[model samples]
Target chain A: MRAPDLIRFARDAAAGNPLRTVLLVLAMSIGVASVVVLTALGDGARRYVVNEFSSLGTNLVIVLPGKSQTGGFNPGNAITNTPRDLTIDDAQALLRASAVRRVAPLAVGTSEISVGGKLREVMVAGTTAQYIDVRRLPLAQGRFLAEGDWRRGASEAVIGAKIRDELFGANPALGQLVRIGDRRFRIIGIMASTGQGLGMNTDELVLVPVSLAQAMFNSNTLFRVLVEANSRESIELAKSQATAILKARHEGEEDVTVITQDAVLATFDRLLGTLTLAVAGIAAISLAVAGILVMNVMLVSVTQRTSEIGLLKALGATGGTIRTAFLTEAAMLSLAGAVLGFLLGHAGAAIIRQLYPVYPAYPPDWAAIAGLGTALVTGILFGVLPARRAARLDPVESLAKR
Target chain B: MMNEPLIALSGVERVFQLGDSEVHALHQLDLRIDSGEYVAVMGPSGSGKSTLLNLLGLLDRPNAGTYRLEGRDVTTLSPEEQARVRSERIGFVFQSFHLVPRLTAAENIALPMVLAGTAPSERRKRVDQALKDYGLTNRAGHRPNELSGGQRQRVAIARATIMQPAVILADEPTGNLDRATGEEVMRLLEELNGKGVTLIVVTHDAALGARAQRQLRMEDGELRQDSRQCAPRT
Candidate 1:
């Protein structure tokens, strides 16, 4: 038969039994939609985490104090706590690197602050004037600590937004002399209400000069060093240069671990990419199931239409033509199901985006195409047995069945 | 070519395997049918009349011997070639009026041409002429279930003859109809035979068989009688 007539004949046969057609289509569509929606969710999670990490700062290289053992059973270096301490001078020495743009030596401690007849314990972060620039922080009111000698601090402090509200309420908090850990320091600035990053809430911490913070805590060891590279391409250079400079300053001891932001981002991307593929594999199982369903329904259809088949053979339809007709019917049903499933999956992804606007839940192009291709292949593969069975039926016997 | 028969079966033997036992359906049967001749095959149940009809329609293959149609040795032809011969030279009318229930009268009549890959314009023209000739023009759009038994049989006949085959095979064509409708169907078959199409009717009804110019009676997988009259009684 001609292609158009064959298609019409197959279409008519499928339409002849509406219930079976709908069931087969529904099975296939569900399989495809699951693959699409699951992949979208898996990939969406990867994007969300990568976005949060990228928002911290660009071209950042962090220096954690201690020499991490590459491979050994040494318990002392397991937690990366080496005996040698990273001091303020070691952080200052990193400034000599050509790729380093700004360096912030950090020191952290808990202190009780009494101001406006109110006393509260606050987490204190001590750093230089360049700390704001390196961390990309914004000031809500007044100025940050002034730029001066790194060795001597001018007894100035910066209060976080939460601390300012709790201690002063409606009162002006800028320039207030707040006694923190038995030392009186003038509040130089109030920080903007930025949320959390890597577990620390910027809104609730008190910022002070690193020199005074170390003296007040009776410790000479700096907490960490945050380095900002000149550009994205300079991050690796800045990291290696800072490590080498810090090693020389630490009396030739490699005592600090330098890590770039891109390495961490790449690790997360790979982990989530694998997760998306795993879920897609799980969803593909349903397509196989749908293929089997097509096979079962088609078998039943062949048995039920024995008389019709017999009539066609009696009317001079070759077995090959009969086989082609049945296969065409199967393909038509599968194609319809696949298209419906594609639309359903997109709608499902759209609903996910609507509910969680921050998440990008679009299915990848390869995944959508793969789902459609697999559905078609599975349907046709399972259809072969039934088509052959119909072709081999004895016309004389089948005609006598009625 | 003029002396040759339209269908010739010589030393044809058909065997059926029933479990481990073998049953002979047609025992070395020999028959010849000429073009435009009306013949009736009459026999009791299991006497091989149905087997003869099936063999004649090429629906079943003989285990031994040669069968020829239109001067071609058809028994040895490939299945595809046999289908082509069946499509072009043979037509079948079943006892139960086996019209596809899903299709309209018009589509059913166009089925043979459709299977042969006839062009749409030609199929439409021929189907229209068939519908008019069968007096089913008004019922062209109706399915088999919507038509009466006589109308359904008319649709089947129209489908059978749509290809204008050289021979028409009718197997108890009037078995499912009332007496009056049966006579009407017989008259239609006779009308086609009058127009020079070879007609073969397989029936057990003596009265129906008596209307044909030639009759072959079978018993025990063998022909018991072969008789021909000068003319079929009106």
Candidate 2:
């Protein structure tokens, strides 16, 4: 038979049994939609994490003071017990590396800042004048701390947007003296309002000179050392150089962990990439279930239409033709279900995006194609047994039944 | 009529195993049917009339036989080749007027041509003409359930002749209809035979069997008589 006629025959058969067709299509489409939506969610999480990490800075490396023996670093390790301290000397020493562009030594501590008798506890991040450029932080008002001797302990602070808004309100707060941790410091800059990122709300932080924070806190151990590479190619070189310099400064003991930003991003990238595949695999199992459903339904349909098959055979249709006709029916159902599932998955993803606009919950092209392709292949593969059965039916026996 | 026989069967034996004991459906039967002959095969139930029809229609294979169609040894042909021959050279009308319930009369009539891969335009033209020839043009769009018994049988006749086959094999062509409708259907079959197309009708009704130009009577899986001549039964 011609291709169009075969398709028409299959279509008419499906139309004849609308309930069966709907159930089969529903099973197939649900399987495909789950794959699409689940993969989209997995991939979306990966993208969100990657974006968050990239937002830290480009070609950046982070140096944590304590060496984690397990080689796994967590944000809580910043304040953990350490055998040695990474101070301003180590930060200054890193500038000697040719690949290193700038270094910012960070000292983190909680302090009560009182302005006009109004006191609020805030997270204080202390760093040098170069910290502004290294962290890619923008200033909303006034200049950042002036470049000066690292040991002199300059009394200057750059408060976050939220801190400034709360402390100063409508008044101009730059150049105003605020008492932080029993020390007076002039507000030299106000940071632009950047929302929460990587577990830190930058808008609520108060930046101060590292020398002053170390003196006020009565400690010389630095919390973190943020380093910038000269270029993208220099990131690895910078990491190794920073690690060597820190080890050398700490009596040849590798007491700190120096990790490039790309390494962290790559780790999360691989982790989430695997997660997407795993979910897709789990979702593919449903396709197999749907395929089995197709087989069962088609087997029943063959039994119900035995007489019709006999009529076709009596009308001179070959076994091959009958097989092709039934298979065509299967393929049509799966193709239609796949297309509907594709649209449904996108709609589901769109709903997720609408609920959480921060994440782009878009399904990858490969996932969509794989889901549809697997559905088609699975439907056709499972259809073989039933089609073969229909083809092998004894026409005489089939006709005799009627 | 052509000199060469259109259908020739020799020592055709068909056996069926019903659990243990074997039933010989067609016992060493030999028959010859010429082109354009109107023949009736009359036999009681269990007399192997249907088995003989099935073998002649290529719907069943004989356990032992040599059957020839148009002077070609069809018994040695593959199932696919036999199906091709059946599509090209034979037609069938069932006692129940086996029209596909989902299809209209027109689509039912066009089914054989569709199976034969005829062009859509040609199939359409021929179906239209067949509908007109069978007086079914007004009922072309009606499904089998909506049509009267006579109309349904007319549609079946239209479908049977749409392929323009050399022979039409019908099993109890009027068994499900009243006498008036039965006569109408028999007249249609006779008209096709009159057009030089061979017609074979299998019926248990003596009246219907007597209407054919030649009569074949079977008993106990064997041919018992040929009314065309006082010839010895094979």
Candidate 3:
């Protein structure tokens, strides 16, 4: 039999029963939409995190004060605390390395800075002259901390736009004093907004020369080291080189760790990818149920149209033709649902972007394709039994069923 | 009968199993229908008239018999083979005038040819001829529900005979129609029989049975009467 005729019959049958068709489509659309939306969010997050990490530069390696995994590392015949040594001294020593471009020892703590009568608690970061270069922070108004300022232990501070607004009005205070806890520091320049980086709003921070932060916060511990590679091509080499140098300086105590932007992003992507698949997998159960629903509906249709099927058979319709018609009906319904789901999911993604644009930035294409493909396959796979049942029906028995 | 038997059923027995209960619908029935013959099988309800028609039409199989159509035994053909045999050699008309509600009369008429993989041009040609032959040309574009009962039955007949099947099995062809409409349908079948197409009508109405050249009366799953009619005699 001609394929078009079977398709026409399937289309007509689906159209004839609007309520059932609509229900099946609705069920399938939810599955496809869920898969697409979750996948988009996860993939976008992976992309964003990778981009943020890349902004930190290639030659950079961060040293933490803890083990990468277990009990602890002993500085001896084995590796040393070099990777885990997150300290200002290591930051200083790294600066002396020939391969390293620049190193900035970073200390962060929260403090309430009061201006006149108003007060706001903001993140206070301490670093030296190359803080801007290593952290890749651009200046908005004033100059970043200089080597001279840090060497002289000057009480100079640079603030983000949000910090400037909270601590002081729009009036320029390029040379006014601001209190860090009880100590006073002269306001220098303001940093440009970098939106949100790794969930921290960069614009909500206050920056001071590392010396002033050390005196004000009353702590000498540096949480992380910021390093910069000279060129893009030597990023990994710079990272490894820095690790070796830091390890030797720290006496082989393996406490510090180095992570490239790509490595961090890969981890983030793997985690998010798993989460997306999990959500899509959970929604797949519902999709499978919807497929079963389609199968049941087709079964009912076959029973209801017993005599009609017999009539078609008597009119010379082959069994294959009958089976193809039902299968086509199911497949078309599934594909239609997938299409509707895709449109709805895109709309959903847009809404998320409008509401939380900073979070999910990119929607991956594979999710949409996978969702549609799964729905179509599910529809046909489940529809097979009913189609075969309809096809194998005896014309005599069917017509006589009445 | 000197004429060739286009349909022959020998020692046919059809039994149905209903929840551990066995019921015989056709019992050792032997029958022969000659080419171009117009015959009506009549019986009360449960008399196996429809069962015999089903067996002869290849819509079913007999457990204890041989059914030969055009000199070929078709009792043991596969389901697909049966469908092909039914499509090419057997036509069907029902009391409900079973025209697909969604299809136009022309599409219905061309269904058999389409299923048989006929070329589009040939299918169109044959469908057009059938529409003209059944006086349904004007109703070709109408769906089953859109046409009157008489017109719908005509379309059904057109569809059934489109492939020029050797045998036409009609079960209560006009049972749902009024007297005038029923007569019109009978006349159409008679006209086709005149064109050398063997026609078999299954009905309970003795008046309708009178129109055939031969009559077979079934009772309690058995062939109770075999009579030859000279002129529309019941």
Candidate whose lDDT is highest: 2
RMSD of 3: 4.7
User: lDDT tens string, model 2, A131-185?
Assistant: 8898787889998878988777678888999999999899999899999989999
Report the lDDT of model 2 for residue B21.
90
Each candidate structure's TM-score, on Cα atoms with residue i matched to residue i, is 0.83, 0.89, 0.83
Encode model 3's per-residue lDDT on B1-234: one tens digit a residue.
Answer: 355478888998999998999899998888888888889999999998988887777777898988888778888787788888888888899888887777899987887887787888999888888888888888888888899998988888888888888889898999888999989999999888988889999999998898888999999899999998777422
Candidate 2, residue A202: how far the Cα is off, in Å:
0.8
Error of 2 at A305 (Å): 0.2
Q: Tell me the deviation in Å of residue B79 in model 3.
A: 1.0
Top candidate on DockQ is 2
The TM-score that candidate 3 achieves is: 0.83
- What local lDDT does model 1 show for residue A226? 86
lDDT on C-alpha atoms for all candidate structures: 0.90, 0.90, 0.80
Q: Which stretches of candidate 2 lie over 4 Å from their true place?
A: A66-85, A128-156, A168-177, A183-194, A218-221, A230-232, A247-255, A356-364, B229-234
Fraction of native Cα contacts kept in each candidate? 0.62, 0.68, 0.77
Off by over 4 Å in 3: A37-59, A64-102, A107-130, A138-157, A172-189, A208-223, A230-236, A250-268, A361-367, B1-4, B17-24, B119-122, B217-234
Task: Give the clashing pairs for model 2.
Answer: none
